[model samples]
Target: MLIRLLYASRAAEAVTHELIESILSESRSRNPALGITGILCYGADIYMQVLEGSREAVNKLYNEITCDARHRDVTVLHYEEICERRFAGWTMGQVNLAKINPSLLLKYSERPVLDPYAVSGLASVALLEELIATASIVCRP
Candidate 1:
């Protein structure tokens, strides 16, 4: 069965552009072989990610992420079997939330910031859908 997992975590330290690129580089290289697809959003020292794949793969990946040194206070926002992949084409799409419009952020967040911890899982998914539709961020192979 296919499953989708959403989680939010605080960066253990300041996250830089190079660090983000490195993470994406590794994800793009590893995810395809594992049959995983997802979107990663980062800003304000917070990260909100959605992973979709087989139950085994998604669970394994989430477990590994929980142990990663780069993340702290990792909280699973949502996890469920899904009939379709929301991020099917991207092994790991990325969005720098700082670049998105403040008004858009206000739709899902009260602070007009990227605080996934304060947003519901469904709202997080909706925010991602909006981002994708706007072509705000794209992952290229």
Candidate 2:
């Protein structure tokens, strides 16, 4: 079974290259055989990441990430078994906080101290789909 965890970071631009590199390296090095994969997004003041793998591997990865200093205010979203993967194309794929959809972030939180559950949680998947579609439209010439 595959597990999916959605986490939000308290810092917006706090996710540095060094931090990303460290996460990627650790994820790959720690589970060289599990074939884990993920994607990261950063909005104005939050960081969201999706991790997928075997149940044990994904849980372990989540534990490691929670202990890391680079993140704060972590939240899990939509964890369940799936026959298909939304991010199976890369090994630890990470996108900087700047590339994420601002509207999605806005939907997720009005501000750090004022987070509304409707933005980036289980219900946020709908927002994510909307953002992706909007992004795809914007990227077109």
Candidate 2: TM-score?
Answer: 0.67
What lDDT score goes with residue 18 in model 2? 74
Clashing pairs in 2: 42-97, 107-119, 108-119
The candidate that achieves the highest lDDT relative to the unseen native structure: 1
TM per prediction? 0.97, 0.67
CA lDDT of each prediction against the hidden true structure: 0.92, 0.59
lDDT of 1 at 67: 96
Q: Write the per-residue lDDT of candidate 1 for residues 1-141, one digit (tens) a residue.
A: 999999999999889998899889999999999999999999889999999999999999999999999999999988889999989989999999988999999998888998888879888888988998899877878
lDDT tens digits, residue span 10-87, model 2: 652465667657666775565447767666555445566667788888888788877767667777766777787666
